[model samples]
Target: MTAVGVQPSAVGRGDVVLRADGLSKRFGGLLAVQNVSFSQYDGEILAVIGPNGAGKTTLLNLLSGVYRPSSGRLHLLGRDVTQEPMEARCHAGLGRAFQIVRPFPEMTVHENVTVGALFGTRGTTLGQARERAYDLLERTGLAAHADKEAHELTLLQDKRLEVARALATQPRVLLLDEVMAGLRPGEAQEAVGLVRSVRDSGVSVLFIEHIMPVVRDLADRVVVMDQGQVLAEGTYHEVTANPQVVAAYLGTEEGLHA
Candidate 1:
């Protein structure tokens, strides 16, 4: 399925890695996502932003296969996956990091990441998964805490753990749901760098973020949503300057740039 009014490579970056075509989601009588569509380029960092209740998280859930779209389709790497389950999507190269960190309290940090490496893809033995998990812990700056239980980490460490676990899946595309939500300025900067490293490692990233500065720093392009649908899509500079996008922020663009 082709994205609405999008040429797939319309952003003039790498090849299209993720596409949403006329996507919609309904819970009971309410349409949480309404005919939204966009394309994310390979190796690019695309951000989704909107005001409260604009369906950003709902849209992310759809993309991550948490909620099946009531209508429309989703394609990953040019393959149709609208009917796929979350695990299927993961194998198809889709990974997701949630805003809330939910690590297993009884497992050590290494053990938690090992679970992801073990299950995210097929054919990996326990030994291989453990090795891969250790590599990820080092890559994510958690090597020093590898033996520590998940519940023992600070908020920032837990958040980093979420991203590390997702990366252990070796996904071609990563979906991040406000990974920066609770981070302090310094920690957020570190997370921003980690995300960049992920993109540099050849993963396309699609994220939902509330912090304007982080979006400006990380996103190559942005999709602005309002009232369950896309209001505009373009570069950070372009969307932030859009009059409709400005009005959607309660008639004040200041909040968006702040």
Candidate 2:
């Protein structure tokens, strides 16, 4: 396998990994994401947060090439991948874990992740890909269940498997959609630790999460959305405390307290 060069700065503690400029998407008459713009620096965990229908998922879809943008551009490590197909983007080092975990029920956990390694990056032998897949499974703590059928796994394990599959692709940038939604509080903390470990391993993460506490604890920066537009962007405390953000999404004091 040919190694993709990592810049010294990017290998350092901080560097810009992904950037979006005026990215937008529409579905029929509905505009799901409108001129959204943001940048995720290398080694940082950037969180996208909003109430339901705020277009967080849609924005991710555009970034991941699941949906083409109606306007604007997407740059991954300074490359314009706005119109690139999903496979092409994956080859370019973009990886995504879906909000809805979709594992091949009949396949073993190891087989499922091995598929990602086979197709992702440039190319490699089946043996090499399987080796990489096993390493990813171990990193994501799914090694114990590698031989089990995907359908036999619990919800939390399924989530970990989704992440493990994405990691098998050797992505430089990963988009995680609600990996913590159904996890218990303790489980959520463990997932956060895994995310931190992924960043420590040189992969940058942009995640959409609804759980406020997890977002507050994990994100280096937070971007809030409302009605498909950015309502606020800042640190977790700054964005949550913004009056406009509260009014637009969190509602009144009673609403927030509710």
Candidate 3:
């Protein structure tokens, strides 16, 4: 599909990098997520889209270890991490970038990334972490701003920094929560390119996005959610064509872009 005049690259499926089975989360009497399940293959860019309060954020939190599932199991790289803490999941090859870009304001761009490199994975020496940070800065196109304080960058740059820091963890899978939230059209296009580059580097990507066009252009497969459960799973065309999805999220065929 063409999006903003850009075509997505061909995706090659590989081993399952992440999987969720019968996942559920309970906040007292509320079932924020219920029996949600999906698999992300190596090198795939997967998008989860739904209306507000559809449990997308809750699902993200479960995957990233911010909240343990009240029921069900999570597997990362073939290991069970259902009960693992956030840091443990990071060590097990799960990286996450939030919708809100929160960089260490007092730290330089390079130093901020360096912090991720140092703590994300085990046995990384400070020297090695510094090297990795600089390399990530270049890969994320922040090399020119390496010495600048994190607070001095623009919104797009902050988004890039969020992604760069996540990549520094050397995760086999990356979870992004609405990374395009406040970006203008041009900046959103740039963010899309960055996400594509990240997938090209061999990391499986799973993201929750509300922008239909971005979901169409970036995702290899689309998973639709509503009322805390997966409503459908297929290509962008297939899911958008589903009548249930149309009523619950898209509103109508033409509303896909609205």
Candidate 4:
């Protein structure tokens, strides 16, 4: 995997890990995402951002196989996966963490993560899965709370558990949807570090985020969407500076600071 610090083009055209080609999703008459396309390179953190209902989550759903595209194609590590189901996509190295953290309330944190490890890619023995789950708990800072019930955690801890569960799947490209939504600034900063660590481990991350500062800090590239269409794509500074992107977010790029 290439380092995140390098320009994406520097990785060469062949390094594309996840590719979306004219992807769209529709519910009756509503076209949630329309002809959206982008590429996430090896070891890059790419952010998708827009106002509420801009179809960021819908696009993520399309990527993760939560919804098959109404039209167009999706490629994971160069394999066509447009028609695959969620489990198949997971097997193809796609992982997702939803904005709403939904741990099994009755399960211990360790058990919650254990389920992921055991079921993710298939093939691990029970013992190996248990061991991997424990390691992920430690890596995600949930080791101390491993024995605690999932419902006993703070919001931030729950968020970490969400991420840890996803990481247990060992995805090559992890899709995170608003993972930092309800976090305090300090907690968000910590989450930023965690995301960086994930990228450092060679996972290409494509995330949907509403928080601008978090996007600026974590994303090697930004994809801006508005009213179900991609408005712009570039580095944080470049996209935020785009007139169309600024207007879509609300008048000026400074609006992101709000």
Candidate 5:
């Protein structure tokens, strides 16, 4: 299927890189997530879209090991990691970039990324991590800003730094929580290219996005969520055309073109 903004590469989906089966989370009286299930295949770019309080962040937290599901299971690269800690999950090939860009303010951009490369997957030497971090900085177009302190970069540069740091982990699946939330139109377009390049490099991507154009352009498949449950899932065109999805999320069939 053709994506709206950037055409997806001819990468065939292989084995499941990540799987969530019947996952749910409860917060006191609130059931934030309800039995969410989905699989991310190797080399795929998946988008999860929903309105406010739709449990998108909660599901992301579950996937990234920020919160263990109260029920169900999570598998990464064929191994059950439902009970794994955040660091354990990172070492097991899951990486996440949060909605906010929070870098070590005093550290150089390069040093910030180096931390991820060093501890991300384990066994990486300091020298090796530094080299890798430099490479990632180059890839993310932040090499020019490498020596600058994290607090010195602009919002877009900070966002790039966030992605670069996450990529430093060498994860099989990257979970991005609204990486484009604060970007200008041009910046968002640039960020989209970065994501495509990341997928081209063979890491599967799962993102939660509010921007319809971004999702339409980037997602190979869309999983629509509402009221803490999956409302529908399909190609951007297919799901946007779904009446249920239209009613719950898109508002109208014309919303698809929006």
Candidate 6:
């Protein structure tokens, strides 16, 4: 697919899909995210990266309504949704996958995905939802394990299940938090391809990842955060080559910038 053009004003407009401004969150004395601002255009993969405590996950939490920002403005599809609850955010077309897999251990893969279908972007009848869930499983290469208990799947399969479940919600923009964390090299590549396919299907993606290669391969733009604020924002090459990013986060490790 061709790269989309950048429109600064359109980014925060109602049609922009998702926008964050001066977003911050605090827990007691620790400031998780501080005055961070950015926007995700429709049908684009925007990757968020930083060092271990740079607040990447905290930013995702605030955007998805998992944790309300201490002070900030959040807009989804042009509506002021900063104070919306998690469920309301989900209904507003926000889907998320946790860094730690959270599928129901006792439920079948299909069943778990069905919960998303029932409560996701496009609500469907049971039959339609089942068909959609199966299609999503097939797309993610998990069709054979549809009937398997969630706990019985391998780590890679478990991660794919999380993606499928999020897809089942029919979100307009999906927030993936380290879905590629534990995968081997080959597996990570395959997962990256799957994410590209997701974006091609017209859903936007905002991903937080530590694997630099995956970020380079999947993101149309990269946003770097450090010390609770945006440290840099640009294409993969620009962000990686930024001196501040290298010294503070990328370091001299080749793998960190892969």
Return the TM-score for each candidate structure.
Answer: 0.95, 0.92, 0.94, 0.93, 0.93, 0.92
> What lDDT score goes with residue 128 in model 1?
92
Candidate 2 worst ten-residue window by lDDT: 1-10
| Candidate 4: residue 247 Cα off by (Å) | 1.0
- Report clash pairs, candidate 2: 15-42
Candidate 4 segments exceeding 4 Å error: 1-14
Model 3 segments more than 4 A misplaced: 1-13
Per model, state how many residue pairs clash.
0, 1, 0, 0, 1, 1
> Lowest-scoring 10 consecutive residues by lDDT in candidate 5?
1-10
Ten contiguous residues minimizing lDDT sum, candidate 3: 1-10
How displaced is residue 126 in candidate 4, in Å?
1.0
Per-model lDDT: 0.89, 0.86, 0.90, 0.87, 0.89, 0.87
Against the true structure, candidate 3 reaches a TM-score of: 0.94
Number of the top candidate by lDDT?
3
Against the true structure, candidate 5 reaches a TM-score of 0.93
Candidate 6: how large is its RMSD?
A: 3.5
lDDT of 6 by residue, 1-258 (tens): 122332343533234788888899999999999988887888889999999899999899999988999998988877788999988988888899888998999999999888888878554789888888899999989999999999999988998999999988888889999999889999898889889999888889999999888888899889999999898998988888789988989987585655
Task: Report the C-alpha lDDT of model 3 over 8-38, residue by residue, as the tens digit.
Answer: 2222457677888889999999999999888
Ten contiguous residues with the weakest lDDT in model 6: 1-10
Give per-model CA RMSD.
2.7, 5.5, 5.3, 3.9, 4.6, 3.5
Inter-residue clash pairs, candidate 6? 14-78
Tens-place lDDT digits, model 4, residues 125-212? 8888889999999999999999999999999999899999999999988999889989999999999999999888888899988778
Q: What digit string (tens of lDDT, one per residue) describes model 2 on residues 97-168?
A: 997999999999999999989989675889998999889999999999999999999988999999988988
Off by over 4 Å in 2: 1-13, 252-258
